[model samples]
Structure formats: C-alpha cells, structure tokens
Target: MSGEMIYPRGSGAYFEQLRALLPRGAAWICEAGTTLGKLLSGLAVELARIDARGIDLIEEADPRTAYELLPDWERVAGLPDTCTGAPETARERQAALHQKLTSTGGQTIAYFIDLAAKAGFLIEIDEHRPAVVGMACDAELYGEAWAFAWTVRVLPFNGTQQGELPVAVAEAGDPVGIPLRGWGALDLECLIGRARPAHTTVLFAYEVEPEPALWFDFTR
Candidate 1:
C-alpha cells in the first residue's frame, strides 16, 4: 500500500470507498481517524445532538468520521479532574474503561464497531498478517436512526475467517444491559499464529465513515 493514499483508519476517502458496499439504513461506524480533505466531501456535517441531559454527537459515522467526532482524552467529559488522583488498581482501570466506553465521546466511536459483527467486521490487519473476522456479534443503530448509511471504512484484522481476534469480545459474564454483554458471552480465545513462533502480536480495533461522493485525495 502506498503512503500516497490514506490508510484505512486515517484516510477519509479510503473509508468512504469501503462503506459504499453496505445496504442503506444499516450503517458502519467506528473509532478511527479522518483527513482534513474529508470535510470537502458531503460528510462535512459533524453533527452534535444536544439535549437536556447533555450535548452529544450520537450520530452514525464510519471509521474515519467517528474518529473525527471522538473527544480528545484530554478533553473528555466526566473525566477525573487534574486535582483528582490517578487510579491505583486494575479494578479502577476496568471501572474507568467502562465509564469511558459508555460516555458520549467514547461511545461515539465504541457504538459503531458494535455493529461490525452483523455487518461483518475486520477486527485487525497490517502488512504481515492475514485478515481476522467474526470477533463481535452485531450492532443496531444506537443514535439517530437516520444517520449515514453503511458507506463506511473498516479495516479488517489479519485473518479472512471468523474468530481471529479472541480478545476483542464483549464478555458474556458482564451484567445485562452493559454495552458488550453479548448475552453474557465474550469471544472465545484461539491462537492465531502458534506456528509463527518468531512473531509477536497485539490487537486493536478501528472504525470507518462516509465522505462526499465526489471528494478524493492521495498524497501531500
């Protein structure tokens, strides 16, 4: 892949092309990056759903669009103030991660990939690994129902088949109604590269979103 075109998570146009493959009403949202060039496209509207409870941009976005809308960790809502102390334990981090995932800023990105399962997801990917799939169950639209369609960008993991990312699952043991409680089930664990003893692996998820129909760019 040339650095000329934007990569999956960072490139807006790259994402727009990927999303055109999905059905309307159903959408593809994610937690990734967008390009300045994306604004020139029809997706220029970065909506904020303001209400009495709080101000939220709970609209659907593909990988890139969602990335653009997520609040900077430094600017996070309900975040611990600098005067507050840092978490001293793993339990606290788990609590904080859950708190962050549900927060508008976090869920803005978190909610989209939630759908990757039904829509079919590519959990992780890079130069060396095959594409991984079937990590999440599926997601229904959470925000305004009438947001963008599935014209989103989602980069797949290193395997083409299902169950590539064993760690990214929503735990089954978690409480009901907790986001990621898949009937109290999490993805099963499977070794992806036991044969490749020389390599090491870590996993992460990214998202995709729509851009204008005509806008396109590649290069500095």
Candidate 2:
C-alpha cells in the first residue's frame, strides 16, 4: 500500500478508527447504513472542522497570513494614534503594522533616511545653522531658532533608486519586481514627523524632476 493516504482525515478513516474501538460483537450495530454509523460520521465531520479551525488560527497569528485579523494586530501596535491616515489597502496596512512593530526608534539622520528608504523613498537631511560673523558670504542670516530646524529633501520618485523593498518589507506583502510609482509622500512625512526629536523642528523639501534637456537634430 502507498504510504500516503489521500483521505487521511476523511469521515471514512474516522469511522474505521471508531469502529475498531468498539466491542467485537458490535460490528452488526455499526454497519455502514446503521444509525450508529451515521452518528460516528457526523462526529468525524465536527472533528475535521475543529482541526481546520486550529490550522487557521495558526495562520492568522502571522502578519503575512492574517488577512481578517489585521485590525487586531493594528490595535495591539497602537496604530493610527500618531500615524494618521491609516493605510486603506491590505498590503499597505500590513507594511505599516510590520514597520511599527519592528522599529527600534532613533533620532539620528541616518536612522531617518533608512526609515524612508525602507518605505520606498529617497531623501537627504539638511541641518540648518544660524548665520555667524565667520560664515561664508553666500550664507543667509537667520535667527538662533534655525539651529534646531532641519529639512528633509525628498528626491523625485525614481523607481531605479528607491523601488527595491527590504526583505522584511517584501515578505510583508508588497509585490517585488514592481516599483512604487506614485506621489504618496504623506506617509514618509508623517513617519519623519513622528520620529523627530521633540525640541527640534523638521521641514520637508520635495524636488521636482527637472525637464529633460532637449537637443535639436538640425544636423540630420
């Protein structure tokens, strides 16, 4: 006989196991069409249903497979508290939840840049300094408050540079090989704002892609 049984957990398997447990003389009472056999078959169905439900619970515990249980995961992660405009799509939501749970929290510029990159954005941080007597001639004179102000320069979304998702993020449901092609920078802004130091002010500067240089082919 083959080692693999196609209906390993089906009603027939359960019925045979159950019938084997009964007293030897009870065979007549447990015949296929008998009422006792019917009862055993029904019991087997409930057992199979219970086994399936247990498997589903295991799957729901993982963020990658927790479709219906995502809301619960979000609540546990304290989502939408400061991260406004909760993501509507399942992929985005899962990514958000994964990001929240995995973030270790940092205040460094590199930390912020890495955060944005993982979310599919390329950015540069510019720290502002007050104009001093020794400053260069081209420097702008500003108050001391500028010392605590910084700007995050967001480059135009170039799929070649920023479309690559981190391993963990890709595993969270974002499709690989496809670039994030859109103007949804709000999420990146919110993320930076939330993580910035309490006493410091952060500004965002979005750089639009410059028009491509056009050359006349008059020589043709």
Candidate 3:
C-alpha cells in the first residue's frame, strides 16, 4: 500500500445509489475509519442524553476503569484477550488475530444489542448472510423514531509487489425488500495505499416521525 492518503471517487454517486434503495423513509450515509464499538457508543450518548456507557472490551486495557468512571451507565464484560500462537508466516499471524478480533467483536456487539433492546429500543438484524446489525425505536422519541444501521468490513493489506497493491471491492447488489427494517445495502470500495490492515465502518441513520408527518429524514 502507498504511504499517501487515497480518497475514493464517486462517493456521492455511490451514496445516491444507496439512497435509492432505502426503505420508504429518508436516509443518510456516512463512512468512517472507526469501529462498531465507537459507533454504538455515540448512539447511546445521543439516545440517553448522557455519556454512552458500555464495556470497552475491545481497546481498553482495564474494563473496570470504565465501570468505575461511569457508574450510572450500563456496563458489560469486555472480550478476553486471546493469544496468537507462533506462526511461520506473517499471513498466519494476521489471519489468527483477525479471526480472534472479529469473533470477539461480534459477541460484544450482540451483548450490547440485547441490553439496548431490554431498555426499550427495537432491534433489527439484516437477514443477509453475515447479517448487518441495526437498531430503531418503537415509540417516537424527540418527535420521531430514530433508526441506525451499520456494517463493518475488514480489509487486509497485502504488501505491494511489482509496485502495485490490490484494491478492495464491495460489489453492488439489489435492494433487500424487507418491510420492517427497510432494505438498503451498503457498498463500499476503498483503496488502502498503506501497508497495514484496516477496518471500514459504514453507518446509516434516519428518523421516522409519527403519522401524518411520518417520513424518513436523514440526519448526519
């Protein structure tokens, strides 16, 4: 991968295409270089009007610290640190760590979703293979029912050979016609010019108001 930054082209067109596929409500798309944990934390803050509290099992060294600091927020256990055994090649180590993190991350997210649901938020899981995770509100909060959908893709960086690196591609697909969740697939193609593995996070958010004024309105 190259050392310089590489911004993707046709981002607007790509977003427009996704918007067309959104369920009968207004929708918005945003891309970032963060993780699911961070995204959910932000959502919790928005919904609760206070600091979003969750176990930082992904990046934090001391999960207890978060619990101590945010005593009022809901807390859960973090993922256990896994050891990557010695491997003959770099690829093996990379694969091992990737699998470990992905598995743990999914479990943590699942736990968070359940906690949110129990707290009165409606949850929606994308039915497509490897299902994307989503959440929405049943009752109108702040004048509308808010919904959020997100998906993560891990892209491993393959060292450049002969002065060229591979480009990541997310194939375009037909709109998933599910009614309750509303189907809009996120397709992201990114070029990582650096020689390091990275994760791309895609988030969609919209608000549906009550009857008469009920409609999906994209926010952020």
**TM-score, per-candidate, Cα-based:** 0.16, 0.66, 0.16
- Residues 1-220, model 2: lDDT tens digits: 5332233365566767876777777454765556876777777777777878888999789876677899999889897565456788988888877877887999898999998887678899999899889999888898999999999998775646745323222234667774344345767888889889999999887666733569677887
Off by over 4 Å in 3: 1-112, 118-120, 127-198, 210-220
Over 1-220, each residue of candidate 3 has an lDDT whose tens digit, in order, gives 5332233342334334443554563233223433532343344344443222332433233322333322222122222222222445434434433433344323334553443333223333231122223535442232111123233322222233222222333345644552344222211111111111233233333222212436676994
Q: Candidate 1 vs candidate 3: which has greater lDDT?
A: 1
User: Model 1 reaches what TM-score against the true structure?
Assistant: 0.16
Position 115, candidate 2: lDDT:
86
- The C-alpha local distance difference test score for the whole of candidate 3 amounts to 0.32
Order of all candidates by TM-score, from best down to worst?
A: 2, 3, 1
Which tens-of-lDDT digit does each residue in 24-107 have in candidate 1?
552333223334334422231222112311322442132122323333432443334332234565455445434545544212
The local distance difference test score of each candidate is: 0.35, 0.75, 0.32
Supply the global lDDT for candidate 1. Answer: 0.35
